[model samples]
Target: MKPRSLVSQSPTSLKLTTGCEALDACLRGGFPCNSLTEIVAESGCGKTQLCLQLSLRAQLPISNGGLNGSSLYLHSELPFPFRRLHQLSKSFHLSNPNIYADHNDNPCDHVFVQNVHSVDHLLDVMPKIDSFVKSSRTRLPLKLIVLDSVAALFRSEFENTPGDLRKRSSLFFKVSGKLKRLADRFGLVVVITNQVTDFVESSDGLSGLRIGNLRGLYSSGRRVVPALGLAWANCVNSRVFISRSGDGICEERREDDESGSSSVGRRDRRRFDIVFSPYLPASSCEFVITREGICGVG
Candidate 1:
């Protein structure tokens, strides 16, 4: 019998492009497979937008920086934004026509959207995902699994009591372990979104800042920390942050300036930061959300 080679057994080397050149470069190719990546940010900071773009891009061929597979999006927030996804798919398919020439087919159809109600609901659903991935019903191989927002699942379910906190932490490990296992076993890229909470300073005025990294997290002119606290933070393999500044100038600065732009109105300037990652150094880049999709701004 032939022996298995190291390269053939290792799945961690694979990656899925984020569909943006600048953001891809910052992430050292893109979100790595065989790992659990947490995208953290405040509301309306383009977290879901990025995840939606990734779901579409994951369907492209590997040569084009895609996994040539399907994605499972488990949303715990608002109803799955099918309308927004339709818009993104139209632009994505148009941009990559060589591979999508017969683009009459809808890409959104390939993305499976599931609504998760709460922590208990998610736990019940977690074990079934393994079977879903192996089933022959799916048209394409599953390469990515996205949980729209992990924070929402556990947000109001737990109290400040020690027993409740410990239980919540245990659940965090269970969910993360299953996600990481799926990623490792199937070479799937798991990306989970996390909401943020206000960062209140302690008596010494510095304890809160030490949560994830030395710099700390701030967004929209206010200091905030990723929800679910430190116990949950330690579960994921990587953490990425997206922040929005409300006073940002429009993407077309020259046009806005020339139009004497009070009528132009300001847009939020969003930034993506690699808070911590085993394969990447801490870094960030500015990005914008447009009709096409989310893209890095140089």
Candidate 2:
């Protein structure tokens, strides 16, 4: 009997591209597999756009900055944006014909979209993805799982109920444990987007500033913190923040436009910051959401 080699038995070392160059560079390649990366930001800060782009990017071959695997997207706050995803796919395929030539076969086929409304719905559906290892014989096993806006369901069911704080805390740990297990066992990249809440002023006067300051749409000149509190915060492996730096309006700024203007109406002057990560350093870079996909602007 031959002994198993360390390379073969060892877990896969791969960096899932975030579908954005500057973002990936900030993340030291991209969101690392076998961990949970939380993308937290205020509403309309390109959180969903990044998630949508990732669904497609995860389907590409590793040579083209993908895991060559499928994804499971748990949509919570909004309906699945298939139209925007289609636009991104079309844009990428046209730019790299040879790479995405089999474009007729959409990556959406491999990517599963689940609309979860309540905690019950989420708990019921999540375990099903684990069954793929046994039932899936032909397709690539699941590699990525994204939960957009993890705070919506719990905020309604858990936070509001009287004396349910403990329950809510435990519930989060349960879900987090499952996700951590799935990530470690299956080498899946679990990325979750969390909504933000107004930062409560503390006696120290540093409550808002300590968490991370944003001068964007929802900031309203007052800082905000990621919702779901400390219990939910302890579960995530990486937390990335998205915010608009200048003008706070998210629009495209094209220099070649008919008007000889310089960054006139572009609102998407966004920043991607790696708040904390064991493997990746704390850094930030700017990117824009264009028709094609998330691209490094500066």
The TM-score values for the models, in the order shown, are 0.89, 0.84
How many clashes (backbone N, Cα, C below 3 Å) per candidate? Answer: 0, 5
lDDT of each: 0.84, 0.76
Task: List the lowest-lDDT window of 10 residues for candidate 1.
Answer: 260-269
lDDT of 2 by residue, 4-93 (tens): 576775354687887777887888778788899999888877888998888778877888778888888898886778898778877766
Best by TM-score: 1
- Give the candidate number with the greatest lDDT: 1
Q: What is the lDDT of residue 219 in candidate 1?
A: 85
TM-score of 1: 0.89
